[model samples]
Target chain A: MRIGELARRSGVSVRALRYYEEQSLLDADRTPGGQRDYPDGAVDRVQLIQQLYAAGLSSRTIVELLPCVSTGTATQSMFDRLLTERDRIGVRMDELAQAKAKLDRVIEQVLAAGLTRDGATGSAPVGS
Target chain B: MRIGELARRSGVSVRALRYYEEQSLLDADRTPGGQRDYPDGAVDRVQLIQQLYAAGLSSRTIVELLPCVSTGTATQSMFDRLLTERDRIGVRMDELAQAKAKLDRVIEQVLAAGLTRDGATGSAPVGS
Candidate 1:
């Protein structure tokens, strides 16, 4: 497929796909006309790349991990580095979960306060 | 406390503190000598700001939410906006969690493959 089709299928922008190629996280073949051509599996590859990025892995780390993911032949050091990256992502997930809980608490308090004020004044709740 | 003390206490850098002020996410009073002086609550305020930022709220949204957070006098629009921001954070948290889980699965597969390869060769696991 072309870059546009890949972008649409992967739900990633063309610029980001180009960036992934620049980062060595992705690749594309050139046609006779010198246009980029992606394999059918490019969609899944791009989705995996997006997942790794969302997990907060840098492009460098993603580049390192992608080959190992495909071949399952990582060296000792590569395995250790990938484990460390996984741990970092775990830590980030915990932090984000905590932050979300805090936001939930604040939102509950604000809404409860609004409800109380509305009850006292016998008016519809704000934003209702 | 001065800006330096506030930054130290809040575990934020001086440059970030200055940026917070620039974004109106934080404020400091000017001393007679023109140094920035922060109130005792500034530390807590800065921590809250960091939490909101971690939750992916923009500086503009944080600025709008701060007053209501402190005073509990938000209008209907402000309340709705804040709720929307909170929901956005929730959605982001879900996405990050899914991404983390995907990473976990990949890591497990990689590690398990390494262990099997090591067993077959009767060698210590790679990176062990």
Candidate 2:
């Protein structure tokens, strides 16, 4: 398939697809006529890239992970390494959860203060 | 405290502190000598900004949330709005968790495939 098809199916923009190729996150073969040719698995690959991008992974990180995902291999040491990587992800998940909690707290604090301000002032300002 | 002190205490760089101020995420008063003077809670605010940045929130988002957080007010409707904001944070947390899970799966797949390759080939290549 062409780039357009991959982008459309993956819900990623054409510009992002081109950027991913430039960043080495995606690869496409060149035909004799100079058109890009992609295999059937390209759609899934693009989808995966989109997911990684949305997850806030850098393009470099995605490029490093793509091969391991595509091949699916694990020696003894590799299995241990994968476990470590999984643990790192767990840490990041915790960090994100913490941030979310902080945000919630901040919002609650603000709402409470806003109410107090209005009650004491007897009228809320336009901006408030 | 000085920028260096703020940076050390907050675990954010002096450059980042300047950047944050330029981005309006942090505000500082000036002394008669024209140096920046931070209030007592500046460190906490800076830490909050760093947390938000690490959680993948943009500077713009942090700026928008700052006023509400600093004031700490809530009317009756404000509490409901705060709840909604918390829900949005919850959604973002879920998305980040999902991304981390996907990364773990990809890593696991890669490690398994690598082991299979080594087993079948009797020896793994340099790149593998």
Candidate 3:
């Protein structure tokens, strides 16, 4: 497949596909006339790269780990790094959860005070 | 207290406090000596500002919503904007969760393939 086909199928832009190749995260073969041709597996590989990016892994780190993910026979260092990123994602999720909870509390506090400002502090009963 | 004291109490840097003030997310009175003097409540306000920042609200959005959180009597539009930010945070959390799950699946696939490469594919029994 061509770059456009891969981009269309994988939901990534052509410029991003070119960037992945530049970063050595994706591979394509150049034809005799200088056109790039990609294999069918490039689709899944691009998706995998997208997932790692979404998980906040940098392109350098992704390049390092792509081989392990592609072949599954990498050294312990790569495996450890992958676990570290997974833990980082967990930490981020925890932070987001805390932020959400804080927002919830702020909303609650604002509404409570708003009620007071509206003279409904002591007038309304529960569920009334 | 002065800006440094507020920074210590709030666990935010003096530079960031200044940035918050510049963004109108915080306030301080000037002393005769040209120092920034903050009220005791400034500590809590700084913390609230940090929480909103962690929730991924931009300075612009934070400035727009701070009045409602501060006075509890903002217009309905402001309240609705706050709700919009809350919902955006929720959406971001969901995206992070999905990304994490994808990472987990990739980790599992790598480990499974690593086992196969180690010649343990069909020979290993559970707990053996």
Candidate 4:
């Protein structure tokens, strides 16, 4: 399929597809006229790449792991690396949760403080 | 306080504090020799700004919200805006968690498929 078709099917832009190719995250064979042509599995591969990106994996890491996913044969060290990546994602998730909880607490405090001030000070001075 | 003292107390850099002032996220009154001097609550305010940043809010958003936080009195619309921001953070956290789960599933699939391949194919070829 042409680049446009592949991009449309994958829900990625033509420019992004080209960038992906440049990044070696996606590849397509050149046609006789020099246009790029993709095989049947190209769309799925792009989807997998997008999934990896959303999963907090860098393009560098995804490139290294792509072979394992495709070949279905990874070494013991590869498994160790995957486990390490999983743990790193967990750590980031925890940080994000902590940040969220901090914000929640701040909002709650603001609400309670505003209520008490309104009761004591008889309506806070409003600004535009 | 001097910039260094505030930096040490707030756990932000002198360069970053200057940058924050430039970005209008922070301000310090000029001293006799034109050096910056911060009031007592400046450290707490800087910590609050850092927390806001970690909550995924931009400097611009924090700038707009700072008055509300400092004045200790926000209008009803300001409260609405705060709630909206909180909801947005919640959505992003959900997306991050979903992405982590997708990665977890991919890792699991890779492990299971690798085990099956090793059992049936009898020692898969390892790549460097």
The recovered share of true contacts, given per candidate in order, is 0.41, 0.69, 0.43, 0.35
Global lDDT scores for all candidate models: 0.78, 0.70, 0.77, 0.75
Put the candidates in TM-score order, highest first: 1, 3, 4, 2
Q: Give the interface RMSD of each candidate.
A: 4.7, 4.6, 4.9, 4.7
- For model 2 the local lDDT of residue A101 reads 80
lDDT of 3 by residue, A32-120 (tens): 98988999999999988887787678999999878766665445576777788878888877877887776677678767755332333
lDDT of 2: 0.70
Looking at model 4 chain A, which ten-residue stretch has the lowest summed lDDT?
A115-124
| Candidate 1 wrong stretches, greater than 4 Å | A115-128, B115-128
Candidate 2 lDDT, B10-118, residue by residue in tens: 8888899999999999889888998888887899999877776776667876676565566665555555544665576576667667767776776656544445444
Best by TM-score: 1
Deviation (Å) of B84 in candidate 2: 7.3
Chain B TM-score against the true chain B, each candidate: 0.84, 0.67, 0.81, 0.77
How well does candidate 4 score on lDDT at residue B110?
66
Q: lDDT of candidate 3? A: 0.77
Give the number of the best model, judged by DockQ. 2
Q: Residue B125 in candidate 4 has what lDDT? A: 42
- Chain A vs. true chain A, TM-score per model, equals 0.84, 0.68, 0.81, 0.76
Query: Model 3, A23: alpha-carbon shift in Å?
Result: 1.9
- The residue pairs in collision within model 4 are none
Candidate 2 CAPRI level: acceptable
In the predicted model 1, the residue pairs found to clash are none
As for lDDT, the candidate ahead, 2 or 4, is: 4
